[model samples]
Target chain A: MVKDDMANLMKKIPIESVTLGIGDVARATGVAQSKLRYWESKGYIKNHAVTDKSNRKFTYKTVLQVQLIKSFLADGYTLTSAVARAQKRAIYLDALRSFFEDRFAQMDVADHTATIDLGPFDPTPSKHLMAKRTDQQWRFYLATPES
Target chain B: MVKDDMANLMKKIPIESVTLGIGDVARATGVAQSKLRYWESKGYIKNHAVTDKSNRKFTYKTVLQVQLIKSFLADGYTLTSAVARAQKRAIYLDALRSFFEDRFAQMDVADHTATIDLGPFDPTPSKHLMAKRTDQQWRFYLATPES
Candidate 1:
């Protein structure tokens, strides 16, 4: 019955189970207490209620939102910029995912583990050119298909 | 054959493949061009040695390294801290991987996933709480776990 009844509400965070203090939040999110206070002061989050002698109980949604925000901040977003473009959350996330994929690919210990686009060559520049053109002292940036 | 022949050398950076003008590095990393030039002047990175007549080229490696530094900066780090803690090539790549992992995780629609963990509950009030308790809001900081 618990499973059947709860299944209906599973799509949303349950309000009753949403009672966690700072310690619980810290354990769940791996964030520090001092930093959470700073986030509250900066208005990155708002609590739904403060009861049972003024202890802050965070909702599940707040936890996920905080996680997303933390990820963006980690990916080189300014707090102000992150706030302003909060709705376009996907962009920063994409950058983060691509980074992970590249790392995982590198972990593959196989001959074809490298994932690079050497470009669509005309088939004339043989492996010899690949060697000679690779000037050890020079630096070059290859363009991504989109960039 | 080319890939096989250079398997040993693959671990070494293809420094020649990095490409960035100071301006590009600035824009991509959100650092000022003057700062980029200053960092280079300070020997964080060096330009290629050239014949008397030379065209400037920057490798993608430098750009990616700069991106890694920028990620650390966004995570509330200073240039000094980043250089000290994240200078190892593996560290840079790990930062990139973690960033991307988060982004990828967000992409999954997560179709109403729910999990529950339940255990024993002691309803008895603790004797340790015999003293008076304060009512002001207890503030704390928390960040989601690293991806």
Candidate 2:
């Protein structure tokens, strides 16, 4: 009885750092296995090898990529454009990160008051900033400074 | 003959404010008529008029909205989320407009030098300012002043 209980307890424990199988990824992302395979074939995603032939694994990031591809397809984008846009989304996010990282260093907070110094406003840059206040108010600003 | 030529000229001229038919919108936006009709039925879009029983008209804004929706969907957002995101996009653009409008009033430009006083930076706010120098340099600052 003690041995049986130990085995059951071990079975109940999941590996927290799991590399998901194809089926697991499909179920978690609401995407089809066939589509995931196609994306892999097209170089949109990479598959983790689990065995010699039948079992394939995927990381959580690949699962997210597959889910994003499905959403793009449903939104009427062609496969190539969707992939390109997905890449562009990453670049945009990186730019946003850098933008915030630089600005966060200059922020000052005391009590309910906060202040920011926007260096310069650009007329031709594509992305702009939106400022949100704690009281639910917000504002926007251009990111470019004239030289 | 002159009167006939004048009439033909008038016929060739397009009215600036004309509402677009489904086919016209489809051709202009590169979206299929079927998808446009489906989006309309799904409440992701609205028809300007339901003329007769079959003819549907869309406003110019709807054409722009469809393009935006297509782009968002291509970016891996769900239909519902895409619509919501598109609306947010409009609000963000409006906020950007207001941000620049207010800041532009404070701008001093002379030769290769420009100065803008965005006041102070705040740490507690959700939005912050990212400043980029046109010479490929960048910085970030909070957009709030301490009280």
What's each prediction's clash count?
25, 19
Task: Tell me the chain A TM-score of model 1.
Answer: 0.46
Highest lDDT against the true fold, candidate: 2
Query: DockQ: which candidate is best?
Result: 2
Segments in model 1 whose C-alpha atoms lie over 4 Å from true places: A1-147, B1-15, B49-56, B90-147
The positional error of residue A19 in candidate 2, measured at the CA in angstroms, is 3.0
What is the i-RMS of every prediction? Answer: 25.8, 22.1
Q: Give one digit per residue, the lDDT tens place, for model 2 in B59-87.
A: 54566567667777889999888787655
Reference-based lDDT, residue B59, model 2: 50
Error of 2 at B43 (Å): 47
Instruction: Chain B TM-score per candidate, please.
Output: 0.43, 0.48
Interface RMSD of 2: 22.1
Q: Evaluate residue B62 in candidate 2 and report its C-alpha lDDT on the 0 to 100 scale.
A: 64
lDDT of 1 by residue, B3-85 (tens): 11111121122223223345444544556777666666766655642343753333334554555556667789888776544
TM per candidate comes to 0.28, 0.31
Model 2 TM-score (B-chain only): 0.48
> What tens-digit string does per-residue lDDT give for candidate 2 at A1-147?
001111121122211112455665665566788988888888887766645684666654455456556667879999987776555333222232233333432232333323333333333334333343334333444443323
